[model samples]
Target: MAVAAPQTSEGQPPKIKASAASLIDVGSGQIYFQKEGDKRREPASLTKIMTAILAIEKGDLKDVVTVRKRAAAVSMGQDIGLKSGDKLYLEDLLKAALMYSANDSTVAIGEHIAGEHDLFVKMMNDKAKSLGMKNTNFANTNGFHHPNHYTTANDLAILTSYALQNETFAKIVSTEEAVITWLPDEESKSVTENGEEKPLKQRTIHSTNRLLRSDYQGINGVKTGTTPRAGNCLVASAAREGRQLAVVILNSNNRWNDATRLLDYGFKEVRPVVLAEKDELVTELEVREGLEKRVSLVALERLEVYVPRIEVEKIQRKVVLTPAPEAPVKRGDKLGKMKFYLDDKELGAVDLVANQDVDRLSWFKRLFDKS
Candidate 1:
């Protein structure tokens, strides 16, 4: 594939066209590149991604949700034709909201999770803040047109990072299509306002993420959105070989094309490189007081980093040990940090914990610990 023209005099900065975008390596959990990425902008339907994540994590998929009047009132964009009292499973609503961009389904999930859209929006902000998305704010769950429902591409990426870690969230985000059928036990049969109500039968919801159906292989699920103010936005993920990566595009003329381009760049330049190995002694330091020898530290998470192949030489790692404790040591107690440096810049680091806990020296052992 053709690359964007370089931006720096050192070389080309890869010709990538996007309104606001971020490409990250999931395996390494690194933001490889960004452009207009931190600027706050309207999110539109991208809000459903977080809604899906929260629902899949906390709400029961099989539980039925009775559509409420508030949710039905949101009929501007795509909707699942929800009536005031029609019952659908949490899973179906999730698919409808995520796959079909159904505003009704989005509201259903939001209200079910927190019992109110306003309250759930608070949860969304709280969750976003917890994920370090300082530039994000939520006005509603369905991402409907609102003046204050805004977020940055980078903040959305941070939220995606947290969501992708959850298997259920990953599954829902990655799902391309779902065929939903009512449970045999659904008690109340509801009517459709369009003069027809099928008996909660099978209905298919196609994923809004066109990448799921496109040339990009190993694609996990994600969400797509568009609005007059937001244009086209997407948070897409794909796996290549063994590693996975997520790309977030906030506003683009060609959302699908931009997402694919970003992903291609990730696979080519921002390739996954192991940053740390499990059980590998990353940092070793002296023990304050212990029955055994000096304590060694290891990474809690495998140090994986994604960087441009050209920049690999620029990537250097150094293990930084915390100050030695002054007293008795216990196994598995955190004592230091393992820092991976890139071109003298700290790229990322994981906590270093005591690989093996040590027992305090007994009274007799302390006296004899002269050696």
Candidate 2:
């Protein structure tokens, strides 16, 4: 279930200059603010976010990819200047693609992962559909402007939230700078007299998102994009005191300022409240025919809810557990869920699990007990 956007006492949301924009709570996916968030606009290099997701999930980082002719020929937008037959680790290309918005790196990654550019693009569309990005589409691996290549700020926020869940993806986007090595082309690979291969060349790539370099507190990631048709686009994310927020700005004249102001508004509107801690006991469940008649159920993870400042006192929690189960129950077995609510509306839920093992009682013991 979706949580409604919190109402702010501050009257109006921040004035965002972007043609399309959205600010979302990373944990609960609550929309804090929006400006024509569903309007379709060219994503430009921001499309690399989806490409990075597919590559990380579907391709091996250690795998070596040989740049093809098509990738080498790409000269539009920012690129690492890949040459045909040049080799690089999938990991390096990912860094270049995400941090620097390298167009050629995306093409090579798409070709390497799916063996065809169009097929990889199809995968991108399929993944978008699965993520419930109803207003998004992909026409190319690199976010070069295409007539059909477009997405909304709301959709991009959804994509970024999902991407940040992956440890590798989160790490890559938050990186301010990184160095990637690639084998030199044959023309530059001249061997020494002893026939030893020369060391691979390294290129340093810096993040295109300027907010990462700014004094903005807790600013971490995500990506930046620009093109003649797309104007300027940014997906900026930040985490502070266990609460994470992301803002998407598309076709903006001042994306950095817009993102910062919107994020500030978001942080001011809601505050994080830790309702349950990891391994903290919430309730107990009865176990039938077990050596232990009851088993303690604890929160599998921390449950921190971001509530509006005005509604913090009104928040409530509900624990729903399964009926008595016949043991042998293992530690960490999922038994039920702990749900959060605002008034009558459901906010979110977390799994409740067994805190310890519970073995079934022996038949002889059960029979004697009955007597």
C-alpha root-mean-square deviation, each candidate: 6.3, 7.4
lDDT of all the models against the reference?
0.76, 0.88
Task: Put down candidate 1 lDDT per residue, 229-253, tens digits, no spaces.
Answer: 8888888888887777788887777
Per-residue lDDT over 48-155 for candidate 2, one digit per residue giving the tens place of the 0 to 100 score: 999999999999999999999999999987899999988999999999999999999999999999999999999999999999999999999988878999999999
Model 2 segments more than 4 A misplaced: 1-11, 184-196, 272-304, 310-346, 349-371
By lDDT, who's the top model here? 2
Off by over 4 Å in 1: 1-13, 181-202, 272-304, 313-338, 342-345, 349-371
Clashes of each: 13, 0
